[model samples]
Target: MIETTPGIIISFVLYLIFMLLIGWIFYRRTQNLSDYILGGRGLNTWVTSMSAQASDMSGWLLLGLPGYAYIAGLESIWIAVGLAVGTYFNWRFIAQRLRKYTQIAGNSLTLPDYFENRFRANSKILRIVSALFILIFFLIYTASGFVAGAKLFNTVFGLSYIGALSIGVLVIIAYTFLGGFMAVSWTDFFQGMLMFIAILVVPLIAIGTMGGIDSTAASINAKNSELLNALTQIDGTTISAISIISL
Candidate 1:
């Protein structure tokens, strides 16, 4: 947990203000259901890419990955490698085909709509089932983000858990209510950039603070020799190279 300082609090407040301002700015543009739902399907490649990445990752990139790496050391690299390969394949193969298919199939805007249209299903059951599943999963997904936000706030500001959670929820609801899709996309782009900067800067800072890579490596090896190796024994169990790759 980072120590709570005036500068950190000010900066966070300013960020929230900027996000709300963006919502206000985009609110006028969101005139109808389609615009609110899909940004009118008019996003450019960069916005689309960043927004997709941000939405997909949410707090996972900031919190979950770092936490996993801290605990698992080099073994965590396998998770990163797998994700990179999967993301590449998804972008290269699935994205274009999905976009084209969605456009051809009655201009479907939502996932449930797309599924129903794609199958040409006469029954409303498919849509209902899809919507129910989506609602359930999405609630779980959203709760994770809220929990991450609350923990972050509590750690940084020493706020009560409920207070932090309420703040997180309110801020999300406010911006989302003001401007639906566009606000979310634009904020996501900003957040993606912030995450990229943090990922790059934090490691460099940590390495420097620890007196460079050599010193850090020595400390890590002293603590747990296996942490220095991507595969093999960490404590007593030998993790095979094949198992590492499979991970």
Candidate 2:
């Protein structure tokens, strides 16, 4: 049987309730399409950047990264490092251009609008293609989140896998539909903070429980000496657990 932590469970429940409350509070602000879809583009830089990264990463950062590290090894750090590098590049190169273009193109909100205005395309086919790309990728992205949520529910609460998937998708859709981008952004910022803190603290707690990094390493080695060994042996290189787990 698994050991339980009442404090952790209670705190998590409170956090969920807080998210639900925030969603409700934003419900009234979404009076029209623009408000729902773009938060009327009123978010300041800090909120915009935080929400952008939050929406981009979602649950992947919180659960997948560390799990990868534990399963694979040091190689998993590359995924996290790459993500940080990519985010930095996006902010440095893309963010300002996007913000400026979004405004200059007669306040175009959706990306397709920006493209249509930028190219002055004759057929609007470009816009259609852009929309299709967004729809396809966002669905893929959101579906991945559903998968993660299912895993989380199954791991933490022993919830039925199908039920967890349904609940996860429904909750995401409900909140997104009700409040739109602003809602998504605000929640993303909040969720990002929670994820950041949780990821940071969980390791410290684990290390404390395990008596430190050296002890933890020794214990893991005791269980599986091969895991502690180098990646290659006799031209049979092992796949790093970190990358595999994160992916």
Candidate 3:
């Protein structure tokens, strides 16, 4: 396949310009931390649901999920099932409660403030611990997203991996710092759609390219009988049974 280098570069520049435009719009509306962090906390259900789900899933839903399914066979479906179940529980139980609690806590604003007010006590330790947890987990989560972007850049454009990683981090931080929730939610809305299309399209293309499922299976088995069988070994131990356990 011939690489349309100029076309690719043009498309990338246009996409970046679109992102910057969105950030600029949000920045104009942003008057304080509230507008930046929570979009003034008046997000409607559709935006809230889409943004929350998009941010929560991040690159995992788009790249990792399909890759897992491809590598692990039908068993990987449990991961999707688990995510659906968790999402249902969150929407059904946690979402409303959190929304109410956040407001009732005198517009608590930050998470720690909400938590402290919920139990009606100024628990210094709990507040500190929660803040630390947020800092650590968010750092790791952001880092992971940067790593994914870097890998994509390396694979697509032949960029140095470290430079790609640094660029990824800077871009995310710039938009996020500039517009915060408005930037995140709006960007996620767009990114989530692209991700949905990508994950759906890639597997369909792969399947079509392989002729058909039955033929693909036959070809695989012909290459190696083991391809038709379950993976029996894991760290030199037989995987007798695998189950999902939630804590």
Candidate 4:
């Protein structure tokens, strides 16, 4: 959990306002189902890609990965490397092809609809099955996201867990219900920028606070020298090949 400050709180309040404002703006523009779902296929490449990659990751990248790194040292990089590779391949091949195909098939609004159309399935079985799987998986996934959000809010705002959770859920629900895909994409684009900046800048700030690279390394070395080694865990165990493969 992040420690809160006045600056952090102010920044977050502004961000929330911006997101809600975006939803309200888009809500007025949304007149038809297509506009609500796909933004009439009008999103530029930047918005699409930012939203795609940003939405791909959730609490795991921010919270879980950091925790893993603290526990496993540099061995946590296995997950990072895997995600980097997968994201590249996904961007290089999957995204564009999927977009074009979905448009050609039927301008499908959802994955299940796309699959049903792509396969030319006469029965609704394919769509139904896909929808069920998505529902089951997303129930778990969305719960995790909410949990992450709750923790983040509590950490940064010094709020009670239930209060934080309620605020987070209400903000998300308000925007999503009002503006749909346009709201989501635009907000995600800005949020993605913040995520990237945080990833790049936070460590540098930490290093500075610790006095420099040498001091930082000395601190880590004092605790556990194995943390400097990419293959070793903090507990002095060698990470297995299977562990690497699984990551």
Candidate 5:
């Protein structure tokens, strides 16, 4: 049976309460559409960077990436490399230009709005198509996050699936319904810091507990030496470097 201690329950409850408090606090300050949409465009460099990174990573960084790495071994490193390169170019080249263009294009609030304004398009078709695609993809993305959260809660607390799912949805809705963009951004910043710490600390602890890198590598190789190979055949066909990057 999975153990769910009282201390863990208490700590989780307190964390939820704190998050709700943050939502309430920001809700009071959210007075207009601008505040609701983009935090009135007043975010500092640190908050903007961390929040963007946090929102981008979300549960995928915690769950999906690790699962992929576990299954694919060193080949999974290509995903990290591709993401790092893409992110760097996005921030370095596109972000500032897009921000400035959006502001200049009648102070557009959303992607569809920006697209309409940027191209000086008068047709409603572009906006309709864009909105439809966004809605479809965002629903898929949001559902994945909810599923990840439910799995996490169920594993940690041994809660029923539906019960854990409800809690996950409630926490998300609470903050989003209460405070909108500012609350999301602030919470994202905090979550990002927590994620960074976890990424560093957990691996260090695991490495130490396993006696070190050499021992860990030896054990992995003992099980299957193919896992140690960066490029290897799967089911008779060689896995291409390009395919790994694409994955």
Candidate 6:
């Protein structure tokens, strides 16, 4: 849990206000379904890529991944490598082609819409089924984001879990309602920048404070040399290929 302070509270309040303000600004600009749903398809390279990455990794990268690393030691490297390779292929092969295809497919705005037009489904069954699938999966997926937000708020502010969750839900809905895609993309860009800094800078600072990279490695090795092993678990067991694939 975090120690509460006036500065911390003030900082959070200010951040929320800033995010809300951006949403409001974009709300005024959103004139139609296209603008609201796709940000007029006008996002620059930086905003689009950063927002995609921000939304993709979310809190899992910060909270869950690190916890796994602390337990599994260097076995976490496989996860990182997989993510990097997957993201590269996704952007290079799929996203670019899909963007153009969406425009060609009767200016489809959503994934289901794209599939419906792309396939010329006269029955509309494809669209309905695809939407249902998306809803089912996204409900589960979005729950993770909500839970992460609740945990962060609960830990940082000493709020009850319900209270934290309520606040997080309200804020998320308000922003999405206010600015739609444009607001989300812009806010996500900044959030991703902050997450990037937190992920890298925090570890670097901790290592430096512990002495340096060499000293930190030495300290960990003193506790368990296997912590430095990339191909094995912290228990000195070789990590199985099946475990890697499952992860």
Candidates by lDDT, descending order: 6, 4, 1, 5, 2, 3
- Clashes (backbone N, CA, C under 3 Å), per candidate, total 0, 2, 0, 0, 0, 0
TM-score against native, each model: 0.94, 0.83, 0.86, 0.93, 0.95, 0.96
Can you write out model 6's per-residue Cα lDDT over 158-184, one digit (the tens) per residue? 999999999888887898899999999
Model 1 clash count equals 0
lDDT of 1 at 123: 97
**Per-residue accuracy of model 3 over 219-240 as CA lDDT, tens digit each:** 7566654434543322223334
> What local lDDT does model 3 show for residue 71?
60
- Scored by lDDT, the top model is 6
Candidate 3 segments whose C-alpha is farther than 4 A from its true place = 1-4, 220-242, 245-247
All predictions: root-mean-square deviation over Cα?
1.6, 3.9, 3.1, 1.8, 1.6, 1.3
lDDT of 4 at 152: 86
Model 1 — which ten-residue stretch has the worst lDDT? 229-238
Report lDDT (CA) for all predictions. Answer: 0.88, 0.76, 0.74, 0.88, 0.86, 0.92
Clashing pairs in 3: none
Which one wins by TM-score: 4 or 5? Answer: 5
Residue-wise C-alpha lDDT for candidate 2, range 25-136, written one tens digit per residue: 7788677777777887788877787777777877777767667656756545556766878779988999889988888986787899989988888788999999999999
Residue 190 miss distance in model 1 (angstroms): 0.3
- lDDT (tens digit, per residue) of candidate 4 on 1-247: 5677789889889988999999999999999998999999899999998898777787777887888888777888889998989989988989889889998889898899899999999999999999999999998987788898899888877789999889888998999999999999998898888888988999999999999999999998899999988886777888888888788
- Overlapping backbone residue pairs in candidate 2 total 2
- Runs in model 5 deviating more than 4 A are 233-237
Question: Which candidate wins on TM-score?
Answer: 6
Q: How big is the positional error of residue 18 in model 1, measured in Å on the Cα after superposition?
A: 0.9
TM-score for model 2? 0.83
Candidate 6 lDDT score relative to the true structure = 0.92
lDDT of 5 by residue, 88-124 (tens): 9999999999989989988998989998999989898
